[model samples]
Every structure is written in structure tokens, then in C-alpha cells.
Target: MTRRHRAGALVLSGMALVLTACGSPAATDTTDAVKAAARQSGDTVYPAQVANCGRTVRVDKAPERIVSFFPSNTELLLRLGLKNRIAGQTWTDQSPPKPAYATDYRKVKVLAPGEIGREALLAARPDFILADGEYQFDGKKLPTIAELAKLGVPVYIDSAFCPKTTGTATLTATTTDLTALGTLLDVQPAARQATAETRERLSAVDKALTGRPATRAAMVQIVDKQLYALAGGLYSDVVRRAGGRNVLDDTVPKGSNFAPLSAEALATKNPDVLIYHYTGAADRAASEKWLRTHLAATAAVRGNRLIAVPAADFSELRAVDGTVTLAKSLHPDAF
Candidate 1:
């Protein structure tokens, strides 16, 4: 069957499975129903009070022309097939952006990274703004969400990537956000389909990894010769769901706390598989050189078992791409 067909079938199954998880409710309103579904499926839900970007805001309606200051949220927009609705996004997508989706991405305006000035975003006139708390708008001092709310733009933080809650029980996929986006944009069916398909695809990868010998994996992002190792965050969770062990899973607390490790430390750990997040000037050839020079002594480099995932995939929404990449890398022999 086609991927879409299989995805549709899987979504139906997941909905049926999730329904069984619904508990007796004191409240049966739409808000309660949405919350219950979100909790049952381990996903983020909307119309909920979320605090981030230094403000506590309640999402009232779906947004059109959503602006995202985070790369992962950019990928999420595309996944929901809301390319037409995206007004602007951060600059992270330019580096080795996925070729197949370039056409879709081009439709949206590309905003400068770390330059989410309220005026800049306000010029685009976005109905909603999605960003991680770490992103500083206008030299890191202006256009806070509460400030934007005053401008009549509802800002929603990407809670999935929030450093405070990431890698904790509170961490959930951005599916509920997708659903809310659907409602906001009047694309409810598309949102539901994307959510179902995304969940189903990840579930299949999880199923495929079942009973296999758990293998070790590591995530390293290279930029300008600096190798920043990510521990347990969105991408680490992707590694786990893909049925591989993350070498740095316990290296730090939750969020994007990158562990600084030298080549020697990497060699000592010597994971079975190496997954890289190369941002700039590091193509496959450059990655090979870096691996050979820094970790040639390790089993991963020696066996040529290294995979380079795009930076966009490091974010929560795009982490699905990372999961698929890891799954294929781990099971390449099957091919």
C-alpha cells in the first residue's frame, strides 16, 4: 500500500486505541475533550494556558499566517501541509534544507535568525507567533509575547522544545498544536490527517525496533569545527523511539543542554552508531573527514556507520525525519 494509505489505516487504529484510554470526566466540554485526548496520546494540546516568551497566554482561536522563529516549527507547518499559511520563519532552513520540500518552503518568507523583532514580525502581520523561549527577539530585549499580545497578535510558545520541560513527562509531540493550527486556519481535516500519519509512522518505526538488541547511538552537531553533543531532548527522544540507545541520554538534565565533549571522550564512549547534526559547510564528505580525524579509532567511524540529519529535524516537529533516518541507519542490512 502507499504510504498515505497505510498512514490513514494506522491513524484509524490509533484513534480507536486512544479512545479506550479516555477516563471518566467531570467535564465534557470541548476544552476538556481536547485535553483528555492530548494526555491520553502523549501529545501537546491547544486552547490551553501556556507560559513562555515571558508571558502566560491562553490560545483562543486558530491562527492564519503563523510566524515561527524556530526551525522545528517551520517543519511542522510544512508537515501539516500549511505551507500557504506560513508567513515567515527563522533562517535555519537554508543550510542543506531538504530538497524535496524546498518548493513548499519557498512559498513562505524567510526571516533572519535571532532577529524576530516585533516590528519585523508585525510587518508580516502574522496572526500567531510560535517560538521557543530561548529565541531572543530584537536584540534579545523587545517584542515579548505579552508585548505582542498587546499588538493583537496571539503568540504561542513551542512548549515541545522549551528547555525547562523537554525530556520530562511534560514533553509531548506538537500534534495537538497541529490540531489547533488546523482549527485556526480552517484546515481541521488536513491537521488531523497529518497528526494521524505522523503518529502512525513513528509507531511503525517503534514496532520495527521491538525485540531487537538495543544498540548505542550518539548525536553530534558540528558548526565551524565545534562539535556540540546533544543529550536528551527532542532528537534524543527520536533516537529512543527509533529503537536505539542514546549514549548521551543521561549525560545531562532535560532540554537542549549540549554536553561539550572532546574527540577523546567520543572515542572512549565508542557508540555502535553515530547520528550527526551538521549545520553549515559540512556536507557528507566533510562529515566523513571530521569523523575520520576525530573518531577514527571508534567502532562507529571504523565501521562507517554514521548518519547526518538535517538541523531542522533536530526540532520537535521535524524530529520525525530524524526518527526515520535513525531507523533506516540501524536496519540498513534489511534493505
Candidate 2:
């Protein structure tokens, strides 16, 4: 769901991309790092090794101070009952993942919508950091997870945004992330509960869609004046699960996730539904107006089948809720 990619396994020795993802299981240094990080974050300490997002990261114990570098990461942390452990958060553009407790976490540090220097992050001394990737991170300074690891800080990235990932994004991948994070944080129960609940929600949606026909659709994300067609990555998974078939699935190689959408081609192959991703209410209105005025003759527009999704929704842990919303909207008669 994040366009920016964080550094991946290629750079890490013995990552899933290399050496059978093997490394020293856990050394004294690992234990020491975990203890120290725990003290800073005020969480319990334990040791764990993870092959995450194609890379290996060792966590000695539960972190007390966890920095969430993306909205989705923040949502995951909160949903997993680690809100108090949040040392810092980025991407504070919309309603926070925990609106009811926004006032409670108001003192948490913010580090985004602009450049975040390595020094600033180090000063926060977070034990762990969760990020979507570097795709959206740009400003006066850029920092890599590799750099943080060197300083004894561990970073976990959502594999959905990994550039090296092959094929479509799967619900399995999201569960894997949750399981791995929970294991590392000593909160496996919470992770399992969250994943199970998400599955149950999706199952309910599936039941509602049992007799429904899927709509022909296209999911598009427009950024920097460029259109990115949703082929078979995270967004497509949502579309498919919601009873829609992406029209752009065959536009590219089978394993490729997304590519620049061709406007002319879209004009000719206009779909039954066009779901546009936009950030902020203003952007949503503008994007819908532009799509309607520019392609009013298309069946999707003429029939008012344009679905405007908040761009930020897909990044959060509750993203599946958005899928259910889409399915219900597309098949209002079913419910």
C-alpha cells in the first residue's frame, strides 16, 4: 500500500535473499542490545531472531519504546495493544489510528511530513522501528534500516511494500508480519487475536458476497501527477477479496505488482468500476471531479461507479474494513 520502499534483504547478510537466511542465532551482544533497548522503551526484555520481509533481524526482548514510521505501523502497534510503547510516530496527516486515545498519546513524538535525520531518531533511542518503506520518505535527509541496525536499533518493514517481493500481496503476508512482530514483541496472543478477527471479518464479507457477481474494476493511485494502476499488489488483494476483478491484472507480467497506467489504454478499456485512491478529503473531491469530467462518457463514470478511497486507509491494520466497505457499496442490494 506504501509506494515508497524501505531498504530490503539484498543488503543484509544471511537475509532470506541470501545464505539460507542464516546467521549467528543470538550472541551476548544480541542479549545486551535487547536489554538496553528494553530499558529505554520501558518494556520487558527477551531475545528473538526473525527472518522478516526477506531479511534477518534479531531482537533480544520486548521493546518499550517503539517508533512507528508509517500510519500502518502505528495502526498495527495500537491494534496490538502497544500504544503505550509508541516512542514516536510519523505520517500524522489524518485521524490517528486511535482517535479516542489521541489525547492520551498526544505527547508522543512525531517525525514525518518532512525530513527525519538519523541523529534525531538516535536521540529518541527507540528500541524498535516499524516502517512501510522509503518510497514516501524524502526530504533533507534519508536514513536506512541498515544504518539503524548498525547502531543496535532494529527496524521492521512491511513486506507488502518491498520492491523485491514477487507476485500479488496476500492476506497471508499481513498475517505473517503480525505473527513475526508479535513473536518478537512477546505478544503472540494479541497478534493471533488480531489476525483471527481480521479473517473472521473477511469471512463475513465473503458470506455476503456468496451469490454476488464481481464487478470489473480498476484501482488507481495518482501521485506526483503520475497514475499507478493497481494490478495485483496489496490494493488488488482488497479488490479481489471484495468481489471485484481488476481489469489491469493482465496489463503487465504476471508477478509484477504495479506499473505506470496508460491513460489511452484505460480510455479504451474503461471498466465497470474505477476505484481511485486519494489522501485527504480535498484531494478526494478533486480527484473524483477530475475523473468524472475527463471520462464522463465512460460507463464507469456515466453510471456513477467511481469509488473514491482514502489513500491512507490501505496503510492501516484495519484496511480490511475498507474492503468490506467497498464490497457493500458495490453490491448494496446484497445486504
Candidate 3:
């Protein structure tokens, strides 16, 4: 299969659907119990919708009208074949458009947290809301989870990109989160298929790299004038699984998810492979020019082995589709 087509398949095959429900207190509990029972029939259990910052949330029903605050979460919903269900979204999210929803995106609805307040959200009347963790939610001055719950709307905060973490991450929460999504969406079989297929693809890549000397790699995301380095957390885990050695395994100078590094410092490390991540309006030419201009001293620049990866997949390191997207970008040679 072509890389893009394979990527599409990879995303579809490893789906996770997060379901949320809200209503009267007693009825909500009863519905939650029934849904939980239904989910138990599958291999995995439903994950508790924990509190973020200081808000507690418990989602029990399948949300009919959903609002996604983050781009990755929106992509996740789109990949689960749930585009029709997404009622509204935030513009800051940077995921690429899925063909399935391309024509309908404009019609779905757009609301900026920076401009519109919780009242705008309430007006949308979403049964469930997916937000960009507690920090952004608080920063945007939106209603707290407790307040949303009081209004009978359950909010799920994305902690996949939690800033407090350090070093290479395991992605345990990511895996469980996807399974939880499956149960919520009533797509348990599809979710299982998606997860298993991802494991298989990763295993195949690992087998291909077996016994070969590991290539030292550095994951760099470009943000304006500076380049942000991704540490060995969930993002790092995917690189390792695809058969690469993260050069920053030992560097803990700053926080883990993203670290600031000088161009000279990168040259000193002299990695065998360099991966560049870009978001809006970036292509191979842009990536190569950036490397030649700012990272000329690096070994990858000298050898011409630098690769520009789509910035969309650089943030959260969960979901089968993302793994597939990254695998194709990092290991095109293996395929």
C-alpha cells in the first residue's frame, strides 16, 4: 500500500472512542451502570473520567453532541468515523482534515475559547466536551469541570500532553484512554482491531531493526525562532518502538515533554538521524532550508539524512493512526 493509504488504514484500524453522557443525577447513574455493563463484555474496562486541575468529571452516556477543544482529540474523533457527531471545535487545534469530514467541517461549527466564554459552550448544548487539559481550560477562563457537571455537561481534559512529565514516556494512559474511547463509542470490536493492528505493525518494524545497530535520533519541533526538543516520554517511546535510539535519553535539564536547546548543543550531540516537526504550511523544502540555515554544524545536515515529519502528529503520542503516520515518516526505508 502507498504510505498515505497505509496511514489511513493504520488510523482506521486502531480506533479509540471516548463516550460521555449527562442528565438527571439518578438517571445518569443508572445509564452509566448499564453502559459499564455493556463495556465489560469487551476485554478492557472503562476508565474513570478523573479530575483535572480541581474539577471532577464522570461521563457515562454516549455523547450525541460533542465539542473538541484540542486538534488531536478532534482528529481522534474523526478517525473513529465519528465526524457527524462532532458539534463544535476550537480553531487552535492543528490536525489535518480528514476527507470524510472535509466538506462538512465548515458546517459543524467553530468557537474560539479565547473569544467565546462558557455561555457560548452552553449554548452549543454539548452533552460532552473535550478540552486541552486543565491549564488551557483555566487559562481560557472557561467554566470549571465542576461547574460544567453542575450544568449537566461532562468535560474530558486531555492530559496526553501533560507538561509535568519527563524522560521517555510509556504511553500506558494513552492505550487505556483509547480503549476507554472504544467502550464509550460502542465500537469495541473496531477499537480492538485498531490496537492489535498497531502492535503488529510496530512488531514488524522492530523485527526489521533487530540486531542492526540502533540509529541515534533527535526529535525536534520547530516553534517560531527556536526549536523545541521532545524528550523520552510517550513521544520518545514511539521513536524507540520504530527502532531508533533517542539521543536525549539522559538530558533532564528542563521539563520532559519539550526542552529548549541551542543549535550548538545539537551539533555536539551529532545524531545519526534528525527528525523535524512542522505545523502550518510546512513542506520538505521548508524543513531542509531550516536545517541548512540553523543546524549546519550537525552531522545529519552534513550527511543529508534529515527528515521533515508532519507537525500534526508531533504533539500527543497516542492512537494507532499517529503511530502509523510516524512510522511511515521515520522508517520509509523499512517499508
- Cα error, candidate 3, residue 56 (Å): 5.8
Question: How much is the lDDT of residue 127 in candidate 2?
Answer: 89
lDDT tens digits, residues 1-335, model 3? Answer: 63323444433433311122232233224334444444445522333355442445565655678887756667667656678888888754354554554565555577762345767877888888776555545525577666777777777655455545434335454555456566655456666765676567657766766665666888777666676677667667767766677786565354466687777777788987888775555544665687678878777878777866655554332334455655655566766
Candidates 1 and 3 compared by TM-score, better number: 1
Q: Write the per-residue lDDT of candidate 2 for residues 1-335, one digit (tens) a residue.
A: 11111121212322333345455343334345445554344333456778866778788767888987766677778778887888888766643444644554566678664346766766777888887764533433645667667767788878676666635666556787887887777677788898898888889988988977889998886666667776777777888888998888877566677688767777677889989987667777777877777677777998889998766566446467678888887888777
The clash numbers for all candidates, in the given order, read: 1, 10, 12
Per-residue accuracy of model 1 over 42-140 as CA lDDT, tens digit each: 343445454453456555554667887766677677876777778888656335456666677666687765455546767888877777654564335
Candidate 1 ranges with C-alpha deviation above 4 Å? 1-56, 59-62, 93-100, 113-118, 137-142, 169-171, 254-256, 280-285
Task: TM-score for candidate 2, please give it.
Answer: 0.79
The weakest ten consecutive residues by lDDT in model 2 span 1-10
* lDDT value, residue 130 of candidate 2: 80
Which of the numbered candidates is closest to the native, going by highest TM-score?
2
Ranking of candidates on TM-score, top first? 2, 1, 3
Worst 10 residues of 1 by lDDT: 23-32
Model 3 vs. true fold: TM: 0.73
